[model samples]
Target chain A: MTSTTVTSDVPALVFVDDLAEGFGAPARPFHGASPFHRADPASTPIDVLDLGITRGDGVFETAGVNHGHPQAIDAHLARMARSAALLDLPAPRIEVWRRAVQEAIEAWGSDGHGAAKLIYTRGIEGTGVPTGWVYVWAEEPEGPIERRDGITVVLLDRGYRSDVAKTSPWLLQGAKTLSYALNQATLREAQRRGADDAVYTSTDGFLLEGPHASLILRFGDEFITPGTDQGILKGTTQGDAFDWLEGQGYGVGARQVRVEEFAAADAAWLVSSVRCAVPITRVDDREMAIDRQVTDGLNAFLLERDC
Target chain B: MTSTTVTSDVPALVFVDDLAEGFGAPARPFHGASPFHRADPASTPIDVLDLGITRGDGVFETAGVNHGHPQAIDAHLARMARSAALLDLPAPRIEVWRRAVQEAIEAWGSDGHGAAKLIYTRGIEGTGVPTGWVYVWAEEPEGPIERRDGITVVLLDRGYRSDVAKTSPWLLQGAKTLSYALNQATLREAQRRGADDAVYTSTDGFLLEGPHASLILRFGDEFITPGTDQGILKGTTQGDAFDWLEGQGYGVGARQVRVEEFAAADAAWLVSSVRCAVPITRVDDREMAIDRQVTDGLNAFLLERDC
Candidate 1:
């Protein structure tokens, strides 16, 4: 492993030889974060800066790193395959991506924390290859625990392209794509309105997912999040936790969660690869009880799985 | 005016001293076309590239240039003003823009063509000044005819963000901005579906406008198009044509236009600054009768006004 010093406060970038030619490296430790690099490196790296990515014209996946190993790598890869097929981009080679992840983990050394991102772009202009950009970043567990307490979410009645392919077309559903300007804008607007995050509602008032994030699952003992049909990005960690809960005899299902029903839920939690599980203490300023069972179950699952 | 040798097939680009700068020696002959320059003079001398245009972060107006003069310039300017306000961008000085147009006309010399473009952008990174880029490209006249034709348009359910603004958002709409990838994609899709241009519908089925254009008087003589309330870019030419028609004792108003109604209109035309009242001859292989009065009225109105 080689270390290079970068003087600018911007993210450090590097070039990887294994990801084929022309792929730019991520700013050292912030894998898969938006605005990957503030400046374009001089090397003209191919894998990272392709138009497919610069235009948000591709799909991706981020898997939870457990003991420096990506968990459920197959599941994340399967989702990416589905997303790539939907977007009409070429699917990535699962084996090659897995190898790249392993190599990245080995380079990061043992004490590395956080998730590993498997970024598959449409590759170079004419090769028709599903170019991949993989990197591992340390995940900081600093999400507000009050988030698990409950969240005050406002319904924005505008700005979302498709409500059907929420998780598949993550380009809008916080799929970790480069085209996140609007999602960022939506969040800014929500912040301006004194809300934690904004849930996009259809023009006709159908409840959609949150911007650059997913909706909270809150309904009795039956935890429910908006289905893939609802246009919410299928969060990796969330999916894993739900599966684990279901194995433990809990009801987990994807359903058409309505705005009113979401507001009236007994407890709610926002899930993501990085945030893991955070409770929403309020819904549009309405307070709700934080069910200790849900949090405990999630924490135990994370611990057992060592994510 | 000093004539320069034109060599490149892509046309020469000329830079101006300022947004308000003029270009013709004896400027009387050339009046009412915005001045422009190439972004990289040494690379492409004769290629005129508008800096404000390349970003698609600007607003623009296309007006009919009749007998070397811009028609309906005030109405176009007014619409651009509204668009700029929507994006919180500064509006260009009307008089200065008008003079720049005149300078551009003189620089291009008489070409027996008519078409003026007014482009205003957020300007370069940091000059603490709103730099504007303007240019007018002449479209050779197709023989004057009294009868009008109808255009065949395809209905695309792609959602656009600034459907309410009269001018599209620079980022998504790509109207004033030179980012025309999506526009080109939509057009290609329309052509594939066997249509002349595309009319984008909202995800909820509300009819918006066309790609890089607007719809006008599709069904009956109602003179309807997607209103600002429908998230459609406010069409200046459509508005002006309707206002003029109403002044001439014709009933005209903007209303929600459906695909079925558009297909069944007595006479339908796509309106824009460059195309100006282009009659629709066929729509998705469906034929329709051309409305002569509508075309005659539009042409007369164009001849009477000075942009």
Candidate 2:
């Protein structure tokens, strides 16, 4: 439902209203020694000319934090690096990214759930350098609720074939780039349709992914997600969950799924780091049977995961 | 080949280095009568938390100003409004935009050529309001040179079909939103391949558009551009020029264009508001025949006419 404000203890994000009113969260925020930024993320100074904002010419990673400990930090960092390389961006400084993460987590405190985001942008107009920073925000209370209640979804075409990732480097198919207008628009479209979520299909009528989450299907005991060849982002949370599930003796894998097969699957999920996984019980507003036992087992296993 | 800098008289866009040195354009930019910002375009303080920067959840219009006269002000505003409506964003207040434009143009002065951009975002996260501003940048020195020399281009797959916009409203295919990461990436890929620009073709090999500009093809005396049905942005400059061309007794129209026809056409031009009309002398590393006379005629007609 929402991505902001997960727990009461997570530090405030300092809204413009908060700043104007001089209320909520301490005025001072934690700062890393990185020259890219000195002020806390809430007040981080980014030149308007920076390609990151102006052209949305940047990459980013969002990781979930529980009790101030970030989940899947390595996966997020690795993906961000891969995205940078794809964009021909300079390699990200791992040590600096680590410091920024540590500072943000400590500054926000360990009391509750939070969301930490790392942004890397090609720097100012003429300079080919980069600007990188970390920002932490409180995860909204709705995250847990969305996880429990499950969701209904509508199908939308992602406007691409399944194999473009192999041919077109310019599309940035799997990168977690900051140019998220379409994803946001898709989610809003779902809301407007009175559906809780959306699943994107490729031009060839194959299930691709959710706008913000990965799609996972269970056929009997086998768990499958669409392969990277489908031009979908690799899901860090889904990968982690699969590892834990395999240890518990579940068959796990990735492959392409046609829209017809998706409709026939025993169970379906739109999985992500923050939401963990939400069962999708409807496709295009048509209600369907759901294997609740599978949903419960996977959700339980994911909650037990510490990293 | 750049989209920035339309005029010589526009204010200097402050670079990070400029901010550090306290030099160049007067640091105090124009504060719109709106409370969103009080600083000028060069120094406007936007909260890092602003969704405009973080998510690229916004719409923008770029208009050229020659002799302090903003070209196509009405068209740009109307297009911005259309884009906002398509995104489910509130209709932009035209009066407010007009004032912001006046303030920016006056501050920059009427000298040579400049670029004015209006950006509108869905406010500071929670307020359900908006953050809008006008920014002016001096036209780059090479814009005219590129126009005169014409440009070479390569073709890339846009990963969409021609009808995605009509069938999937969620894709936001034709709207000119601020989420331009893919467009910028495509341009970089073009530059890497020794080309001045890129033309995007649909997955089915239909001619779509140039990354930021529109594509116009000439077959003898008939001039045609891919229609709106092709999920392409309706080019303001292209439309205006076509109107003038029709009056001048030239055949002008819109329809689906396959890559084959595009390659076989007598000549082609990548048309946009800022670049006007630039000849495409190559596609996919292969040299194309240049009807320099047609290129010259279109560019001259575009340059002589202004809003």
Candidate 3:
């Protein structure tokens, strides 16, 4: 993937050596695909005190860009609204967000495939206002290599019991907040252990979620996913997929997943808007069956569906 | 405290309204109480995409400034360094931070009293560099009065067992990270429930730390804090207070605390660098004992000693 992370050079104050340049230097990132365009990315500044940056007090969603369009825009926005409410943030302006997404989609055209991220932060604290923006970038072509060749997975404890979400509202367990340090750390931890990804098991020992996606298990024809009541962000892509699958007369439902089930499942995969679907062929030393039919069906459905 | 959230006019581009203002704003947050003196708070700019703002991918520390001097500059810096390490961020330059503290303290010049917050974020997401800065502001004169009167607290579930720290490193349980949405939300949850603050209980039922402070229990002359293995951030102020209490020949130690024990203790307080010490006179529906002597001793030690 030509990650915006590496592809677009957003001008920054590199404090290590060029703090002065950060404050006063040249044209950096070539602002890509904008509804609210920063013709000069270098000058699009962020406040030093933005609590979003200072404290990660924010929420975000990513819409997949495939087949020359921003896929699942409505689903992403709806999820963002839910994430906002979970954080007690003001209800987002759906009209405004819709306009931005439309602009983003139009700006990108059908030139390439990537992702568009929508960010909404509680603004600088105390203002009772929020800061919101969109960033769209093309992923490197090799980003989806894993989807074609399944991934190896490991389970890591998410540190909360499976049922902690109902009673502990403050954990914001269902919100997709900007405070992603732990999520990123878990991926690194999995990488360190020679795995491609980590599936979090709640402290109570129930399998929970992947850091950035939802877990799906297939026991023959039944399509099962762990319930959202377990404190994980509801997966928009999974929801979209299940809706389409159920309409086709396939079994789709939510159930508590046990960690050991992955070791024995006939088929499994991680699903998200961006990655679409990454089949789990191996779960911690146990090789599982990968029904190419299930994986292929979901990926094709994910791409063909409209938000 | 006269929160800048409520006091200072920290300028912002209310994107929900003037998205244009966000793109064309002049010098964002009026840099308040400058150490590296921006001269015009209105001109100090933060990049729009700083990961700190984008991801809350950072850590922070607040030094209590009293009688015109920033307290525990060294101790706070040391803790920041550790917080940085926990997040896998680079080790902060202690001397650079020390100079900032010195400059901040020197500039404030015995004015009123409040807190000086030191922030270090992993810069913008794709950029390997990081952003670091300090903000100093005065507290409302009445803010500290709560310390004298004690606070009403409600116990909230922190959603982890006391020992989850050792088993779940990615949780960043002990790190004083900027991902404070949950922390802030817990305090709001407490306030909405008719309480002044919240004390977190580990999922397994052990008493942990407060959202922004450490849990301190007094059993007669015993000065006790919950063990750090419970995944609570080690409080810098609590450490300073414990050192003083021990030097004065009082028994100070770490122990596992239970919820019911609060009702039985001679005194209980939440200690932190900024809040100093807040005695908890009541918890939930249970009224707890608050020993004036113990509360007074700790407060005096807090003000008299430097971190």
- Model 3 chain A weakest lDDT span, ten residues long: A12-21
lDDT of 1 by residue, B42-75 (tens): 2221101112321233455667666667766777
lDDT of each: 0.53, 0.71, 0.71
Number of the top TM-score candidate: 2
- Greater DockQ among 2 and 3 belongs to 2
lDDT of 2 at B232: 81
lDDT of 1 by residue, A1-307 (tens): 0011111111112222223222323322443432122222222233211333223344556666657777767777777766665544554555556667766665555554466665555543344443445556565444445434555666675444445344113123433343333444456556767887777765434566665555656666687877766555676666787888788787888867666786668777766665566666666667767777777778557544742
Best by DockQ: 2
Model 2 lDDT tens row, A211-277: 8899888887788898977778889888887887688788999988889887667778888877877
* Backbone clashes, each candidate: 51, 16, 19
Candidate 3 lDDT, B113-170, residue by residue in tens: 6778787776656756565666666676555887888898999999887887798888
Q: Write model 3 residue lDDT over A1-307, tens digit each, in one string.
A: 0011222343211110001111111211222222233222343334445567667888888888775566877778888888888888777776556666555555555455677777777765566556566656667655588777888888888988887779888899989998888887788788988999989998667888899999988876788899999999788888987887787788999989888676666788899988888999777778876678767877878866655
Model 3, native contacts kept: 0.56
Error of 2 at B250 (Å): 1.9
Error of 2 at B58 (Å): 1.3
